[model samples]
Target chain A: MADVLLSAKDIKIRFGGVIAADGINLEVHEGENLAIIGPNGAGKTTFLNISTGYLRPQAGTVTFLGQDITAHLPRTITKLGIARAFQIPQLFLDQTVMENMLIAAASRQGYPSGFKALSRLPEASEMERLLELVGVRSYAERKARELPEGQRKLVDIALALALKPRLLLMDEPTSGVASSEKLEIMDILTAALAKEKVTSVFVEHDMDMVERYAHRVAVWNVGKIQKVGTPAEVLADPKVQQQVIGI
Target chain B: MTRRIKPITTAAVIFFLVSAVAPLFVSSWATLFALILAKGIVVLGIVLLLQAGQVSFGHAMFFAIGAYTSAFWGKYIGGGDILLYLVLGGISSTVFGLIVGLFVVRYREIFFGMLNLAFSMVLWSLLEKMFPYTNGADGIRVARPGLLGFVFTPETFQYVILYVSLLIAAAAFYGVQRYLESPLGHMLRAIKSNETRLEYLGMSARRVLLIGYVISAFLGGIGGTLVAIIQQIATPEFGFWTKSGEFVFIAILGGGAHAFGAFAGAAMFEWVRFYAAAHLADSWQLILGVVLIVIILYAPNGLIGLRQRYRQSGKRGR
Candidate 1:
């Protein structure tokens, strides 16, 4: 068995009268592409939020790298090598793409002192290289808001990669891209993640993309995981096809 | 290795030269120019906070604190040296900022602004009620401040204040410009853009803001100390909410993109008020309001933004 990099046991959270996550238990192994598939409002993103410390599960514990991290701040969790990309690109809109990358890179390097000069830093080349790896090097000097939806998604992923995390959780990596370009975007994205050897847990709705990239698939239905198995096995399950895939 | 001089550095040199030589040419406006520099320093403090997406309407409280600290030290403790009073004022304001920021940093948007206004008003009321020590609303008289150890004549005093204010303002401009180009400054801007993303990158947004708040308070204190020396008075009005509003107004007028914007805005503001009061008397504020509306409607980024746009268009034309 592969070593479990992240473990969430008995996670429960509710909002008002709605149960967002109910008694959910999940384990993500190292070096595997774990795809979380669910219908709309199935609590897939909520579960990811809990693991990344964006939301505190009302009743459960999260252990990462064998340490209890259920109550740690998102910053602390990220510093411990878990990074997240938002469903919509959460970037510094007024800043250039390179500035966004530099901010993320500089943050992981250390807490910046008042005198720590950002200009002419040795990390600029590395930032450009990261942009190049994500196939957005040409857009480096442009403002983040000026980029098209596809490029913005790539920049968002690049920003996540800048944290140098051991694990990356992406929320809808190809949701906003054109239908014709979805596969191409995923191809570049998956290639970059593989080259970096980073474990990934991505919440995606596209079954084709999941079939191509995910090693293991977890089907979430109404705040609970219905089944967890290899992509072929879970996709073939009648229950998953009827409830999640809706085909 | 040869170090390249930035345009800002060259501008600073030119500013210093002009301030030093211009005062000799127009000695009558020396005090007015000194007052502008003092207020400009305070505006620079506001600019820093504005850059971080936080606005403090109670910054005048720090200004008052600095002025009062200098007044008390000079009157009671017999420390009349200008430099010493500047240091004392800056340190006292910074310490106050550190304490207040513990609670203030948690609030954002209007709540943050209102809290600052509330604190400044509290200070204003205390200044008014504590008549015995603060001299009530009538304000207290500040003795003539000495440079180093020498007491100059009134003529020499004006020159001394001008040179000192210019030197301090120039140094602060350079320091703040450097800070804005630093990694910490980038974090500050990041805090403005998307604080959640900043945290997800493993940097504490609140901590960065606290550091900025303390530095801003220090700058406000220095400005207040210079004001006390120039005007030679410490009034409760210094801590008034309107006073704080004026700082905010200057910040908006100058824009928050560059540190020089503060001085430019202050200069234009002082000159506008000077002329408006001279010609329109009671209607000066109305004139100022119209001017601000135009600036907001046309040049939302203030004078700096206007200049940048013009430069960009000029390049395109070429």
Candidate 2:
């Protein structure tokens, strides 16, 4: 079996009366593109938040790289090589694309010391390469707020990649993007992720994106995993088709 | 890169030239200019916190602490050395900032502003009510401090103080400008942009904020110490909420675009007030209000933004 890069067992969380994550167990193996497909409020994002230390589950534990990290701070988890990209591009709107990339690269190298200028960061070449890989190199000088939705998504992914994480979690990378540009965004994203040799577990609602890129799919229904298997197997399942795909 | 470095170099040259030659030409304005420089230093501290997206309405408390610490050293410890007083002033206010920051850094926006104001008010009340130690509302008097063991006479005191204030302002501007270009400075801007994203990038936003707060307090202290020496008085009003408000006013007027913006704002404010008080007297504040309104509406980024817009329009015209 492939070594599990991230594992969560018996995870449970409640928001007032709503159970956001309930008795859920998941394992993401190294270097695999795993897609989580769920209806709205199905706890897919809640689970991702728990795994990334954004939300702490009321019960259950998350282990990453064989270390228990259920109570670690989000930054601590990030330093341990797990990075996340938000559904809404969480970028520095006032900063340029290259500046945003440099900030991430600086954090990963270790917080900048006193009087050490950004010019000395040593990540300029690598930042250029990452921006080029994600196809946003042309927009390097443009402020993040000025970028179109499709390009913003690409910049967000590039920012995540700059962290040099062993595992990357993406939440709805294509949701805000126009339908026509979804495939192109995913193409640049997946290609860059592969080239960086990063393991990814993404929550995606677009079935087409899942079918194209996900090596395996986990169907989440009402805070529980209904089934986990090859995309062909899960997509062909009658229950998944009837409920999730709304066949 | 050359384009960016050129402006900074030009600004540096102008700053040094003015500092070196201005004393000879306008020694009469030295006292007023020194006061502006001291306040500008405090506003520089505010600029740092503003970069982190945190505003403090109680920084005057640190200013008062710096002033009073220096006063205490002069009165009780018999420390006649101005350099030692400056260090003591900075250290005392930094220690206070470190302690208060532990609680203040956890709050954001209005809560942060209110907490700082509350602390400042408390300090103000203490200074007003403490009779023996602080000399109550009448305040404590500070004598002309000897610099490097050279006792300054009344005639030469203004020049010496002007030189010291200029030296401090230059150092503060250079240090802050360099810092804003640094990696940590980028992180500070990121904290304002999207703190959660910054944490996900692997930095503790709270820790970063606390460090910034402490540094700002240290600067405020140094500024306060200078002001106290200039005025030769540390009053209860030094820690008043309105005093803190003035720092915020200068910071916004200067715009937070660059470190030197603080000085620009301070100079404009001092000159405007000087002339307004001389001519308009009763209507000076009204004129100041009108000027601020105009700046807010036309140049919301402050004077720096106004300059940038002019340059851009000039380029377009060409």
Candidate 3:
């Protein structure tokens, strides 16, 4: 039994006519890769938002490491060792891939004031390794604006990895990726996460990806967790497939 | 143009040396050069603001604050020390900057710029209405400030001002260049690129911007102090909206690539305006307008961004 790293208890939130979260209870544990899968508007992203402090749930408490982080700002949550990657690549377009990774690494450690050169900082090599892990090392000097969508996605993931977080949350990490290329990207990302030994929670649509990469799968539907089990058991459940996977 | 034939520091050293001797060649316009260099310092600060995708059209208020600080020191404190005026000018404007930045840094883009314009206009009206203390639109006379205990005759004062302006300009250029290269400076640029990403990375974009804003206002003060010293007066016109526009104009003219670009842009801008006003006083503004349009059309990067489109530059800022 692994220790629970993040606990969301009796979480509830609503937006006008839509119920985003209704008493959603989920516990992400240490040393496990968790995949959250659901159809659109299933409150998976809203929950991720709540965890990252982008959206304050009308009701709910998010606890990380036994400390209440529900009201923390995104930056504060990041400092507490939570990092997130967006589905759409959010990057400093003018800076190079290497610079982006360096910034992410520097940001985690806390930025230095007073004329300290960024290039001379120790994060350079570490950032380069993260870039390599995500297979964007070859494009290190390429400006982020120049990278194609596929490469941008990898770089964005690399940036998240650079944060060196205790828990890493990603929103539809492979959504923009081509179906053919999704598995391969997931392989590299999961390998990097395994190497880093970071707890991972990802919202994914591809059941194949979930079955392959996720240690455990949590099926979400209409703002509620429909099922939670090992990938085989959850995917085998007829109700989850009908509701979430539409099979 | 080749981007890096010589390192920026080396080029700066050479440029400063040449500028130091420039007053001898153009002795007739020593005061003009001093004024231009001072404006360059102000534009240098604007360059930093531009990096954060923020623009202040009201920086001339800081300039006016610098000039007034010097004027008050001379009138009330009874001293003409240039060092004291410059230090006080920087400190006073920085104080104002911190106070204003606390409010303005919360906004971005047009709101940030408009708020600054609004604040400067308020200061301008205050300077105009406070006739007893401010001397109204006529302005107060700024007595010639002594430099490190030496009172130069008018004939020598121009040269002293030029040399001092040149020294301060060099230091400012170097300091700004260094600051822009630092991590904090990088984050300032990052704020422009994607503020959301910066926040998720665990830094407040507003805090970074405030730091840059205060520094920019301090530079504006420095420039204002120098201009007052050269002209021997501090007028409410110093805080006028048009004067703030000049700071923005020169910043755009120089491009935001590097600090030294501000100096080049300022020199070219002042000279063009001078000649235009001399030759065609009625439509000098028309000539300036044409030049800006041309610059915007062709060299969008300003004078410093002027280079053979290198591979290093991709799809840059929109």
Give TM-scores for every candidate, taking all chains together and pairing residue i with residue i.
0.96, 0.97, 0.96
Q: Of the true contacts between chains A and B, what fraction does model 3 have?
A: 0.81
* Model 2 agreement with the true structure over A151-203: per-residue lDDT tens digits: 99889989999999999999999998899999999999899999999999999
| lDDT, residue B312, candidate 1 | 78
Report the C-alpha lDDT of model 2 over B212-251, residue by residue, as the tens digit. 8998999999999999999998999999998999889888
Model 3 lDDT at residue B57? 82
TM-score of candidate 1 to 2 decimals: 0.96
- Which 10 consecutive residues of model 2 chain A have the lowest summed lDDT? A111-120
lDDT of 1 at A50: 91
lDDT of candidates 1 onward, in order: 0.87, 0.89, 0.88
Model 2 lDDT on a 0 to 1 scale: 0.89
Instruction: Give candidate 2's error at residue A76 in angstroms.
Output: 1.1
For model 1, what is the C-alpha lDDT against the true structure? 0.87
| DockQ of predicted model 1 | 0.71
Candidate 2, position B57, lDDT = 97
1 versus 3: better lDDT goes to: 3
Candidate 1 per-residue lDDT over residues B34-58, each given as its tens digit: 8888888998888998888889999
